[model samples]
Target: MSAQLFVVATPIGHLDDMTFRAVEVLKSVAVIAAEDTRQSIQLLRHFNIITPLTACHDHNENMVIDQLIGRLKNGENIALVSDAGTPLISDPGFKLVRAAQEHGIRVTPVPGACAAIAALSSVGLPSDRFSFEGFLPSKSSQRLLQLEKLKDETQTLIFYEAPHRILASVKDMAQVFGADRPVGFAREITKTFETIKKMTLAELVSLIERDHNQQKGEIVLVIGGAAKEVDLDQLKLDQLLTRLLEDLSVKAASQLAADLSGVKKKIAYQRALELTAEKEQDKLDRDLN
Candidate 1:
């Protein structure tokens, strides 16, 4: 029988958030595939775990997948972990998991802290329907283009951003989705400096700029969806009636405005009747000319 592959989740910030099962899996696995050996060392040291770890980040993932598979074929259980959060979520390890499955190995998840979920749970935004946009493009033009594509998206949008780029990203969102769009910003989740604030896109931009301290730490931005558009023709009809009441009779104005604005004649005629008495004497004076 082939050995199993375990995909483990590491704490995003707080070490205490690590689950009991996750620790056990990490301790018992024959070898651990880590994104960064240095970061994983600190995590392992906290729990006093001495399991040997090997690097398997984006740079070396393709080269190491076959080797990890070989170990699994020899009845060795392995655990895959990213520097933080869940493996394969904006991280490496998919190839290894797929290879294990192909060789008839069982793949199990040891879930724990995930930054995206942590932010969503407390951001005070609509949770029923939402979309996760992991990270925007680094370039300003590219990022704006990306935002434009999602301008019409009706679902709540979630995004991950680095501290250095948070201000620019928020500004771009404000530009594309209107300044008054509601937004939530979660920073340094699970850590001592954790902060989550809800405000309009413009307000958020000003807040971040005012407080230099707010610019640090990992960021998760949640923005409300677009608002519905009003019917332009309906608005034009009302404007037309108000203008025509000055010179033309109410009945004549209603008929002309209804044809021009494509509004129902009956409704326009009823509104014209309301204005008839107020301007009846004026209509008679205009008719004499």
Candidate 2:
């Protein structure tokens, strides 16, 4: 039988958020692979879990993966964990997970606290459809280019941002998505100083600028998607042409209405002629009465 690779989730903040299953798995695993052994050791000690932790972070994951896999194939169960939250959630451990699967090793997810999902549930934004754009480019220029591309997205957008980059990121969002765009700001999630609030992109920028505290701690940004576009129907187009034809010639009214309503000029002109005849008939009838 192939030993299972348990991918356990640790608490993002409050230690109590750690699940009973996660604790049991950590205690039972032959060894735990942690992003930062030093950081993870503290949590293990708190729970009286003495599972030895080995480093498997971004820098060393490639180097130590083979050794970890070798142990798994030997029928020794291994647990993969990040410094916080679920592994491979904007964290390391993907390569190891992939390698384990490739070797026909069983990979199981022991789920628990995830910062992104926590914020989304309470943000009051459209949760039906969402896009999790894990951290954006650290460079300002690259970040701007990325935001420009997503400006037209029609689903709620989620992004995990670093404390140091919070203010700049919000500012860029406002500039690209417009100051009036609605956004949800969550900082220090599940911690004592946790803050979750919804406001316009402009408001968030001002709050972060004036209050340095808002710039600190683990942050997740939930931005409202671009408003869905409404299509202009033929009836609405004719109404527009009628209004314009009262003050402008047939040619002018058709051209202006087409430009305003995004309709073809030829169609607008034909509609304008029909409206003009209707108006003239109404006038003649009124004169006779």
Candidate 3:
């Protein structure tokens, strides 16, 4: 095979979820850059894939990418995989992919299973319009601030949370989105002890508290969003607009603000125009002074 970088997706829980193409690529590739060599070895052993795995995680990706790129340029096919699910989906590989693209190396995707999509597919939520907010902030305060920003979102919300912090995260969600918001929780999906349940956020919290085992393992939370246009705080709206305005145009910022804060786009558009005018006025005043 010519030199190329393959982005591969592996199983989240069930081994069978690993696709045939993924196994072939893992076997045929010259090198497998795994997020965790030790973990990837287990999967390799299961499939009898003798390919050697090299470490490629967030901390070392930048330092070691040049070496991998050199190997790829020399006609070696390399596959990038995470510990579970898809790489770069709340996982590492962003830097590597960008580097490969920048260097004009062929990048291919060998897709299989993804936890977020798997969980969302089964959950009875409106998937047509949804946002994947993977892995919320680790700290409670930051998590709450993020939840507050997303409180008024109208589309279904998806989140991947760790076991230790699942309870705490759920509590924050309940507080920020209210107790009655409909949500679904999928735990250890596709595994022997897999469980998928849906209920109000309050009830889900109670369930997790009552059953300690439910707190363990991989988790995907699908939350239903605000049913109608929400009354968002002007300060919060402005704060969101300001941050979004940094990279996006006024029209795009307004639309995104509406999607995130559950405000009508037309209203957000007006607000964006006003914010731009204020910025210009402030600049003009400074110039005059």
Give the alpha carbon lDDT tens digit for every residue of 208-256 in model 2: 9889999889999999999987655877987898889879999999999
In candidate 2, stretches whose alpha carbon ends up further than 4 angstroms from where it belongs are 234-289
Q: RMSD for each model, in Å, please?
A: 10.9, 9.8, 13.7
Name the 10 consecutive residues with the lowest summed lDDT in model 1: 227-236
**Which pairs of residues collide in model 1?**
none
Summarize candidate 1's per-residue lDDT along 1-289 as a digit string, tens digits.
Answer: 6578999999999999999999999899999999999999999999999999999999998899889989988999999999999988778998888888898889999988888888888989888898989999998999999999999887888998988998999999999999999998999999999999889999999999999888998888988877757668656776789788778877889998888877888988887776666567788889999
Clashes of each: 0, 0, 0
Q: After the best TM-score superposition of candidate 1, give how far the Cα of residue 201 lies from its true spot, in angstroms.
A: 0.8
Question: Per-residue CA lDDT of candidate 3, range 1-289, in tens?
Answer: 3688999999988899999999999999999999999999999999999998999998999999999999988899999999999999999999999999998999999888888998899878889999999999999999999999999999999999999999999999999999999998999989999988889999999999999999899999999988885455988899999999989999999999999999899999999999989999999999999
Among these predictions, the greatest TM-score belongs to: 2
* Model 2: lDDT to the true structure: 0.95
Pick by lDDT: 1 or 2, better one: 2
The residue ranges of model 3 lying beyond 4 angstroms of the native Cα positions read 230-289
Error of 2 at 107 (Å): 0.5
